[model samples]
Each structure stands twice: as C-alpha cells, then as structure tokens.
Target: MRGDRVTNEGTVPSDSRRFCLYFAHIELAQKVQAGREAKRTLHEAGVAIKKQIIANTKSNKSERHKHLDELEQDLKILENELKEKEELKRQAEIPENAAKERHQKLWKVEKRAMQDLISRNNQMREMFADLDTNGDSLISIDELQKHRELDTNPENEFTVEEVRSILGSDSIDLNKFNTTVFDQLSNSYGKLLEPTRPTPEPTPLAEPSIDSITTQPSSLEIPTDEEDLRTHTRSSYKNEDDSEDDYEEYNHRGSSSIATSLEHEKHIHDSIAPEYDDETKRLIQIADEARNRYHEVGEKLLSIKRQIDDSKKQSSVDTGLHDEYAAIIDQCFDYEEREYTYRICMFKTANQIPKGGGSEVTIGYWDSWCGPKDNKYLKMKYSNGATCWNGPPRSLIVTLQCGTEQKLTDVREPSRCEYAMIFETPLACDETIATTSAHLDHVEF
Candidate 1:
C-alpha cells in the first residue's frame, strides 16, 4: 500500500466539494428598456405643455390663466396616480410581478398626457368655428379687417396688411386661423361677433294728399273753448273722486306758496300751445294754477300723517331692554358740545345740529342692537352717515359705561372724520351691586 500511494496523486471528488455564494439575478435588459420608455413619456408631456397653435407670439392674459390652471390640475392628477401605483408595486413581494405592474401603470400615465394634448387642440377647433363666417373652413384677412372696424376708437384700427403679416397668408386654414391671432382678436374685438340686425324701412311722410283732404270725416269736431281743452289736459294722475274737504283746505292756504308752481304751469302752457292766442294761454295758466294748489294741499296732508306715525313710535313701550331703561329707548339724549349739539335718539338716527346756525346734519343710523342677549351693553355702531367735505363718510361708535345719570361723558375723533363717544347710563349695568355681593358671599362659603 505504501508503494501504490507514492505512485498516485489524490484528487478531491467534484460533487463532494461544497461552495456558497450570493448574487442578484437582475434583468438588466428589461430595466434599461423600461427606463427609456419612461424618459420618452416625460419628454412628450413637456412638449405638449408648450404646444402653440397660434400665429401671433403675443399671449392674452385670460387665455394664459386658463391654460395654466388646467395644466396645474392635470399635473396634480398625474402625481396622485403615480403615488398610488408606487404604493401598489411596493406591496408586491416578487420582483417580476412588481416590474410588470409598474410598466402597465406607466403606460396609463402616458396615455393621459397625450389626451391633454388632444383636448387643448380641440379647444382651438371650437374657436375656429366661431370665426369662420363663410363656413369654408378658412378665415380671410378681409373678414378680420371688417371685424376690427367694429371697434369705435381710431387707434383700434386693424389693416389688411397687418392681418396678412400676422397670419402669413391671404386666407388661413381652420387650424392656423384659430391660433394666438384669434385669442388677441377675441380680447380686442369680441363684441363685434354679435350679429347686427337689418335697418328698418322708414315710414311714408304724412303729406296733405288730395284724397285725404277730400274725404274728411263728418264726425270730426274740434273744441271751441280753450279753457275746456285746458281742463281736459290735466294729468291723468289727478283723482276724480277728490273730497270737498280737501278742496276747502286747498283754498284756505294762500296762493303765495304756489307762486313757483304757477310759473311752472305757465311755462308748460306756452310750450304746449304756442299757436293759441294770449287769452287762451292765460286761461290755461289759471286752470293749471288751480290744479297745482290741489297738489300742494295733498303733499301737506302726507307730511302730517308721517309726523303722527313718528310720534306714536316714540311713545310706544316696545323698547328691547330692561324695564328701567325702556324709557330711554325712544327718548333723545342731547349732548351739547363746543361747536355742535349732538342728539342720539335711541333706536333711531343720530343728528348733529349746529349751535351757531347751520343745517342739521345726520351723523349715522343705529345699525346693531346692544343688550345682555348679545353679551354687550354699550357697543353701538352707526354707519352710512352724510358725506364729509374732503373726507370719508361720517360714522360714530358709542361705548356705554355704568353711571347713575344717563350722559355722554367724552367724545373724541379716533380716526379721520370718525367720532367715538363714551356714554354713561344707568341701564348699562347687567347685574345690580347687591346681587353681585350676594353671589360672592355664597361662593366664599
């Protein structure tokens, strides 16, 4: 055995030798193709966003705004879809399964981007339909010039030469006609698209024809008395059933107040009956003066009714406050300052009466209700007052403080032409002192 071992070299059996190694089995060719396809899709979408269908380089603000808004919406949708597909792929454990699903998802996104391009082009087609007046699928320079003429301003004039230069042709096909040129035109002369109506035929002149003069109707009769005609000429607004008392009231008031009314009547009478004799005109004037007197009496009666209604409202006990302050609701709180006598009639308009003798001016009207229900006692806002000279409209805000007597303690102009007043009133307290003290005692126990 020693002689045989010396002559033969020992060799390890191939199957008995053990080896362990790790490597990724990635399909490089498939990955490279998928990456190229994704890059191509992204490039196509970029080109679509910058697609231009118009001849002119100028862009309208409105159209640009619309395109940008739509592009943003599309991009948002694309991002959401990509996130959803990525989540789905991550959930799949097998690499082959994930790659196949990702490829399908990416194809869908590419299709969507292509649709956006088609939709944008379709918008241009619809606009071309509006501009194609002859329906020959073309827009001529002459047609554009005619539309330009509709603009009244001389500076707005558009020439055939300008149109040809912009369009680069005498007639633009449907595709080119609906480009940026149409957008600029629509912005400048959109109103010209409205169809104009045909001019109406004029009526024949009312000449004294021989047939009309010969065939004068027998029933035609003109009134002789101008005074009777004038009385019938009274406005249809006059009442037919006016009471005798109203007529008596009209006679009691002197004619001096109606002198202006009489002058207006005379002017109207002269214009209506210029061909009438002086006596006729005078009679018409007298009748008009009597009608005016009746109108003046009616106006006075209306004024009396308004005053009575106002008095009733002031005396009513419907003030929305505590019983103690109910009397103050309708009563006026007069605050006399250096230059003006201010009156704040509760739940009514505030007024500023000049002390030295100027017109009474309205400060503002009460706009909000102030009380416990609103969790406020003294905050009152008055707005829409009479306009100030060289300033904004006057407004006032009143803040009420607790006091025994109702008075306006201080006034200040905190802003330009705006007055803020601190008013003191007994009604400003929500809870009595005795009640608050009792509540505090209970809490301490």
Candidate 2:
C-alpha cells in the first residue's frame, strides 16, 4: 500500500481513481488539517478586532463634540455676566459724579459764609472799644444813650441783669464784643457806626433815697470808680477862705461821723445820687470826702507818732504780713485782656505773653508793698521790667483786697508801661479798722 500507483495497468476511469490507498500518510494529512484550522482562527479574530475598533472610534467622536459644545456655552455665559457688570458700573457713575459736584458746591458756599462772619466781626471791634473810657471795661446806660446808633429807648433799655446776660459779663466784654454783642447791636440798629463823642461831662451827684444805702444805682451795671468820684467832681462855688477853713475844720474833726469803712465809700453812690445835682448834693459830697480824708490823715499822723515813739527802736526786716500770703508766692496767675495774657507770680515776677504766639515780655519784678501810708501791706509793686519801645520801664501795681477767695481781676494800663490790677484774697480780711478805714474811700499809689 505504500508503493501503490494508479497507472495504465489499471486504466480505470478518472472518476474511479479514489481507491488508491494512502492511509500510511496520515501524519501529513493531520498536519495539513491543523494549518487550515490555525488560518481560520486567525482570520476570524482579525474581523472581530476591526469591528470593535470602528464602533469605539464613532462613540469617541460623538463624546468629543458634546464636550466642546458645553465648553462654548460656559464661555458665552461668562462673557454675558462680564457685560452686565460693566453696564451696571456705567449706570452708577452718573449719580456718583453728580453727588461729588453737589458736595463741592455746598462746601464752597459754607466756606464763603464763615469768612463773611469773621470779616463782619473784625469791623465791629473798633466801635465798641470807644465805649470803655476809664479802662474799667464798663459802660453806663446814660453813656450808651449818647450814641444814636444804639437803641437806648425805654422799651429796649438795658437793665443791669440784661446787660450781664447779653454781654455775658459785668463789664463791656471785649471777648464777646465781636460775636454775640455784634449780632445784637447789628440787629437792633441796621448799621453799626462809630459814635462821634465829645469830651465827657462830669457826672452829677444824687441823694440816697432813690437806691438802697448798700447798693449801687439800679441803672449802673457796675460801681462807679472811686477815682472818678474824686476826679470827676464839680466843685461848689464858694469863697477861697471859706473852702480853706472848711478843710481845716475837717482835719481837726478827724472823720468822727465815719460810721464804717464800706459805708463811707457807699455814701458816694447812695447819699449823692445823680438826681440830686443841687447845692445840697455838692455839700454832702464835700463833707463826705473831707471826713474820709480826715480819717486818712489822722491815721497817718498817728502812724508817724508811733514811728517817733519807736525812733530808737531797731528796724526789723521780718516778713510779717508778707509771709501771710506766702502761699501765693511762686504761683502763676493769668489775666487775659485784649490780645495779651497777663501773668503774675506773687513776690516773684510778672509777664505779658501775646496770644498770637510772639516773644514773651517781662512786665515787672516784685519790689515792695507800695500801698497808702497807713496800711503798707495793701498793695504790691513790681518795677524795673522790660522797657517800652523808647519809653519808660514797665511796672505793675497789684492792689490787694479782702475777699472769700483768691483771684486776680481788672488788669489795666493806666499810664505808659504802668499796669494795675486788683487781687482779692482772704488774707487781708483780718486787718485793723484803722488800716481798713484808711483805704475806705481811696487807694493811693
């Protein structure tokens, strides 16, 4: 069977040649079948792999288009939001700019108004300064009536309390003269004018019945100056011999009718009222002043008598009354008048400091108790200070008075570089009647 051949010997029909036995070649047959099976498995696997690739590529393309569309929508939404915000800002700027302009205009108007007020106040200061003649910072209703610019009619007349309220002081307040007083005076009179005044006439005297003995005139805002009483008096026309004899007799009598020190001074305001401007008033004033002067001179004579008695006695430099007010020593007290701040240090120094920031000036230095002859402790003098511009050396006289509290008030420049003020304190309360009486109707420097 291994060598069997289909040749001409068999000569079988081509269709009958299948009977040739080849069973011995089974191994070759098996190898051929295995190759066919491997080819079939390889072709089937390739087809399946190609189909899967096409399907996956299509799905990926669709997903990419969806993602790109979503990204575009988000970008559009963000752009629209940005446009809305910009439009809102543009709308808001219209009112914001307008508000700024309005505020600027209002500020300008207010600034102009404030400047006008200051200018008006400055213009009024010169007019009011003339009202204070004695450097006492006071003005009487009778004095105010002299100016037609002031409405001094009875309906608008100023009482003492009314003046104190409107002026905010007992005197013509310089601080308020340019503010509240300016407004009030301007409202009362349409325009403010500087009063063209004549030389002042001497004030007349009056009787005591019109007002209380202890009280000053109801029309007066403050007490009339004692110096004014003596200096501004009208003399009673009489023979020179009679006047001299009267003075001599008063000196001999020695103020025996002087009831009390305060009462003696009060008689000028209480006893000699301005309504009693007759010969009787003149006689009363003359007698009162003579008694006061007699009291003063008698005390002086007695003081000299004591000094003569102690002529051989050793003179003492003991502090005495000076030490009583030693607590005020080295302590600074300030009194404001006009543009300067007056500073006084008891038994030390005095100064005038400018309010608008300038070099401080030395007013004076403590010198001595320069009061009247009888009571040497009533006034303190400071001298030999910084000189005026080509003038005398500056000096300050502090007049001491008895009061419940310690204070400095009424600073005045009576003469060139010569200053004066009143210092009230409790230390002077216990002085002798003789000392107090000497200063009753007068205080001499």
Best by lDDT: 2
Per-residue lDDT over 42-76 for candidate 2, one digit per residue giving the tens place of the 0 to 100 score: 43443344334445545654664565556455545
- Candidate 1 backbone overlaps, count: 2
- Model 1 residue runs over 4 Å out of place are 1-308, 311-318, 321-325, 370-374, 438-445
Error of 1 at 120 (Å): 95
| Candidate 1, run of 10 with poorest lDDT | 436-445
Over 1-445, each residue of candidate 1 has an lDDT whose tens digit, in order, gives 2222332566332322211111111334445546655544443433232222111112442443465556556555655655554454444324433333332332232233223323323444544555566777677777666665434455956776777876678988753543435445544555433323431112222222222222322231212354643342232113333323323333243211111111123223233311334444454455455545545554554554555455445445333333333445656888888998888877677888999998988888877644345645557777788899998888888887655466888777798768887877645543422122211111110
User: Candidate 1: lDDT of 94?
Assistant: 45
Candidate 2 deviant stretches above 4 angstroms: 1-318, 431-445
Which is the leading candidate under TM-score? 1
Computed on alpha carbons, the lDDT of every model, listed in order, comes to: 0.49, 0.51
Whole-model lDDT, model 1: 0.49
